[model samples]
Target chain A: MKKIMNAPDAFVAESLEGLVRAHEGLVTFGAGRTFIRRRDLAPGKVAVISGGGAGHEPLHSGFVGRGMLDAACTGHVFTSPTPDQIVAAMDETDTGAGCLLVVKNYDGDVMNFEMAAEMAASRHAIDTVIVEDDAATGPSLRSRGRRGIAGTVVVEKILGAAAEQGSNLAALKTLGDDLNRRIRSMGVALRGTTVPENARETFSLGPDEMEIGVGIHGEPGLERTRFAGANEIIRLLGERILAEFPSDVAEGGTARPLLIVNGFGGTPPIELYLAQGIAHRFFENHGVVPARTLTGTFVTSLDMAGLSITLALLDEVQFKLWCAPVATPCLSW
Target chain B: MKKIMNAPDAFVAESLEGLVRAHEGLVTFGAGRTFIRRRDLAPGKVAVISGGGAGHEPLHSGFVGRGMLDAACTGHVFTSPTPDQIVAAMDETDTGAGCLLVVKNYDGDVMNFEMAAEMAASRHAIDTVIVEDDAATGPSLRSRGRRGIAGTVVVEKILGAAAEQGSNLAALKTLGDDLNRRIRSMGVALRGTTVPENARETFSLGPDEMEIGVGIHGEPGLERTRFAGANEIIRLLGERILAEFPSDVAEGGTARPLLIVNGFGGTPPIELYLAQGIAHRFFENHGVVPARTLTGTFVTSLDMAGLSITLALLDEVQFKLWCAPVATPCLSW
Candidate 1:
């Protein structure tokens, strides 16, 4: 695989080093470079932390700054961070108002974050909010329920704002849980990502076939389908997400959805914007006017050519929190 | 050529439609969707307008909003917009303070923008600032001197803020010219982008070879070499750019450079951040501290897997202008 790196094994560490160096004013590395924390953490505020694999950049690390995440523990590409790393993040970010851990619903991630919370409970108040917003995985197939995907960004944004407003640990956890249940995401991948250590694509597909409902980590998608136009792909993803929305949010026609057209690393912004437009029109035709829309590469796999559509049913308070000002490396408004 | 497009020929128009719809509150399309302008155009401020080929997104179009370009005209992929479109942008954006056209130094772009300036001269005051910062082609190679590349983003950011601060058209033109002359850039491409109309990659390369000094529109680069590590590639590009710096900016060692590690669409954020680290060290080793560094996919060539380095020597005033607040769909600060 062609990639810009010094050594395959050192890719994640070196990239993290580069990130800290590039945004020195906004973030800093922890004791062992296993976690990153905001440079200026406010006292008496609930600390919000999140992490997963390293490939989905601007997710955990990039969100660590003012009005967002207080810290993030990072793992190697498509791998979970160790419990020790999660503890490091918690120790560095807890400001007495307590700490909130936003963990994606992956087996490894859930276990590690839970262990970290147990480890940190003696010294500081810590709580975990598990996010499982992916609609592609049915309830019967997996005991872990749906895997968290791009909707994690929405959860992070809302919870980050709520935490910054001096919300206690329990309040922030409740907010995160509520938002996670309201959000749903699904993706389509045209190509697979190449992990540096493996030096090979995670999967392969026919030239005219696409993996619908693909996971961010190149997990097996629901099915292989014929390649089609943007509108069709968007419609399929939208229909699945809308079908699974809570009946109160879906049936009453009073749902004010917040749309996120997330690019899966290698997709260009032009196509993402086009997808956003298609998704917006589709929602409008179905009698829903989105309250807010965010279109960019918020979450990604390593050089994967695909995208995900996320819809979060928003209440007035949640919508207000989503619109709250944020200052981070990847997101600032 | 796998792309998220409705139809090959409809790509540009449809993409623009999506852009306008996605940023409905911030921007609006001119007559016939030929140009996009900020909705809240301030009267009596110099209007900065920029455009070129359509493929390099988030460049001209994404830069339109507060503290940036007042309007942008888009052409087909890798093709220049017509004079009529440029005229339309000028007519819609020009206030009492006149208008400034920021055109890259491509043959078609320069010619078309020049013709549009002449056409619009009958009604409104219009001036043009040509950007030619690429150091790949020597002065003697082509009459056009050098091709404009990613440095155009830097120019727009500075000039956009200057215009917002009520700089007149003449002053904005001079500032753009000064900054263009001081800036130098070089790029490397791992893959060629596929133009929508062509339905084929612009060029091909051996699996282990990379094109250095590649142009935004997939123009041939200076050389094809075996792929190397990130540090080596960055050092090579940095050396070329630093070597071509004007005597004043290079000799005194007092120059505060603004660095832009721009992704060519397909390169992930991890690689770009790593590149930024290497570039930062390269400059520091040479006894220069970058006053400001912006790293992201600001300028891009569709889905080309590569990146470019732009170093613009900055005076205190220009650096301040660069930090000014601006909000747009793709960019916010």
Candidate 2:
């Protein structure tokens, strides 16, 4: 595996070190490197926190700032953060209003965040909003249900805005849960990622084949099919996501959902934007125009060459939350 | 070649289509498809325009908005924009104060911009600033000296800010030229890029090899040597780039030049940020601290897995220009 690093074991820590240094004024190390803390912590506001594996970068950490996450507990690549780390994040960031844990629907993540909540049960009034927006996996595929993927950005954006606007922990949790149910995402992988610690490729695909419905952690999808053109690939992913959305949002024939074409690390912006164009046309044909579109490497799996499509149906409240001012390292408007 | 594009021939057009569609309120297609025009073009303000091959995302195109370029001409991938395209861009954006053309120093780009400037000689007061900051090449390598690369972003940013502040074309040209002289950049490629039209890999390297000082277009650099760890590799590139700087700027013990660690497509954010940390340490060890650092996939060779480092010495005026607000899709502050 041709990966860039000094010591493979120090990959996650070094990357975190660089991130904090680069975004000095925005974020800093929190409670002993257990999490990244936003610089401006408005007391009495709800503390929004989230974390998962380290590879899907600029996710939880990059989202830490004045209008996003208050703190982001980081785990190793594709691994869950220890309950101790989550506790540290909570201990350091929770305001009197309380805390909202934005947990992705993964076995390890759910369990760890739950454990952390239990540990902090006495001091903080906390609520959890689990994101399970991946359309590929569900109760039929795995008993655990869908694994959260790129739609987490939408969840974070909306929830963070709500938190910043003085929403209580319970209200933020309700908002996050509603947003999660409205969003659906699916991805295709042209290549797999090499996990830096062991230097092992999470999965491999033939040169002329692609993985359909792949997760962000380089997990194999439902099908390993022959390679196809960009339009066909995006169509497959888009169709899956649309099918999973509520009929009112997907079949409304006129409502324009927020569409996101998120790159999986290796895919460049040019291709992501091209895919966005194809996706817009595909949705327009289905009578749903993706009016608010975002294209970039927001969520990634190391060096995996692929992308995920996310669609979120936002009401006036959700749209207002998204439009609120935000200043973070990876995202701001 | 594994690329997310439909009908390689339409790669550039499709990407531009997505860009304009995504940034509807900020920009639109000018007169023809030849250029992207800023939607809020201030009448009588100096029109800052730039164009180049289309592979670099957010480069000339993504930088068009308030406090940035008034227009950006688009060319085919890795190919210069035709003189006609530049002329169209100038015709659409030139205000009474005139237009400033920001051209990258390439045989084709310089020639085309010069021809367009001559063509508009009577109608608009056009001044051209050609950027040539690649540290790996000079008189010994090619008659044209160094080729322009990632540093073009800085040039556009500073000039764009000055233009927005109502600087005339002549003043902007002088500022741009002086900024160009103070920046030096160098890159290394772990893998090469395949030009999409013909599916041609611009250059090739063995599994255990790397190319040093590689240009952004997949052009072979100063050497192709065995692969090494990230620290040693950054040290070599850092020393070479530092040698090209003026003695006063580089040799001064306390001065800090703005450092840019730019990725060439395939490398993900984790690795890029890690490299940035290393590059910072390397520069500090050489007695020159890189206080202002910008790291991202700014300038790219399509899907090439590598990165470049650029250091620009900014005086107080230039620093303030860098601090000016820019509301573009790719970059904003």
Q: Which lDDT tens digits does candidate 2 get at residues B1-333?
A: 878888888898999888888888899999878899898788889999999998878688988998888888878898999889989988888868899999888898999999998988999998988898998987467887788999999999999999888888889989998887788999999988888888888998898999999987777799999898889889888889888876776655434478898888898888888888888888778776766888788888888898899988788788789879998878888
List candidate 2 stretches off by more than 4 Å: A248-256, B251-256
Cα lDDT of model 1 by residue, A1-333, tens digit = 787788887888877877888788999998778898999999999889899989998788988888889998889999999999988888888878878889999999999899888988898888888888888986668998889999998899899999888788889888888887789999999888889988878889888989999998889999899998998998889899988776766775545689889988888888888888889999888877887889888888988999999988888888888889998888888
Q: Global lDDT for candidate 2? A: 0.86
lDDT values, one for every candidate = 0.87, 0.86
- Compare the candidates by lDDT and give the number of the best one: 1
The TM-score leader among the candidates is 1
Q: RMSDs, each prediction?
A: 1.2, 1.5
Query: Residue B273's C-alpha lDDT in candidate 2?
Result: 83
Q: Give each prediction's DockQ, rounded to 2 decimals.
A: 0.75, 0.74
Candidate 1 deviation (Cα RMSD): 1.2
Candidate 2 residue pairs that clash: none
Error of 1 at B130 (Å): 0.7
